[model samples]
Target: MSLTADPPSGAVPATGGTLTHNLVNSGAEKVVFKVRSSNNNEYRVKPVFGFVEPSGTTSLEITRLAGPAKEDKIVVQFAPSPADAPSASSAFNAVQPTGNVTIPISAT
Candidate 1:
């Protein structure tokens, strides 16, 4: 799992900013992410937090996608999303693509 901040570059914790985590296949070959809302009084003034599934094998990194209300700083957790699409109520799981796929990440 990888942790990343918005602007796809330097660190800038402000409103409408972003943080990203990349999950690539290794020996495990699968991973998941858990994001906690930074929606505190401080963040309330500048609310922003989101995540995206990494789909490539390039150097791991996190960047932001197109959306309203960007996030700057973000806390991230890694686990598994799912190999197959399952119900939201089911346990978390994520599938690692068989080949190279670059999953661009952003705050959506």
Candidate 2:
């Protein structure tokens, strides 16, 4: 699974960036996301990846931190592991999980 966005300039002025997505575990394990970036101006991003469990709904959250925001773009990758890839909600769900989501973080 993967999620990304091209936020308009000044979308997160005080902070850095934001991320939101829905994951669905079709397999029988948990999904793990591997995030990376290039030329990120050093903006601290907090990423949360997991399923809601029982509900089988999955989601990933990326939060921007306060400080000098990086000018780099973000990249996120998800790989369903055998031990954690059964519940979709346990990670994320996709009412449509591959598009733009509201920015929910800001720099202090």
Candidate 3:
């Protein structure tokens, strides 16, 4: 999967705020992306998993719920969609995990 995240990093209010990351897919095939955070207890991510068509783009919203606003990271796991898969989300059923892209997060 030829994927990348922009802004490299994100900033939110130390007290509590929301941050968003844009993911660009430049590959030739569709990809299923699973989003997660290093600290799930302190943060919430939307669209935990989804799919992106080739040359398409999608956004992930990472909102800091409550914490000291320390540095954290978001993990974006991606795998190519299988031809027979009913949906992109099912791609995660891959026999093995493929790749991941990490995005740094911090409180402003």
Leading candidate by lDDT? 3
* 42-106: candidate 3 lDDT, tens digit per residue: 88988887777899989888888767858889998888877677755666666254788899888
Which regions of candidate 2 are displaced past 4 Å? 1-10, 14-29, 48-71, 84-108
Model 3 lDDT on a 0 to 1 scale: 0.81
lDDT of each model, Cα atoms only? 0.35, 0.42, 0.81
19-67: candidate 1 lDDT, tens digit per residue = 3333343433333443333433332212122123454332333333333
lDDT of 1: 0.35
Model 3, runs deviating above 4 Å: none
Give the Cα error of residue 72 in candidate 1, in Å. Answer: 9.2
Clashes of 2: 36
lDDT of 2 by residue, 1-108 (tens): 323233412234444455554544444434454445443454444454433223254544544555564344445445443454455344443322442223333333
For model 1, the stretches where C-alpha displacement exceeds 4 angstroms are 1-10, 13-28, 37-73, 85-90, 93-108
C-alpha lDDT of residue 45 in model 2: 43
Let me know the TM-score candidate 1 reaches against the reference structure: 0.32
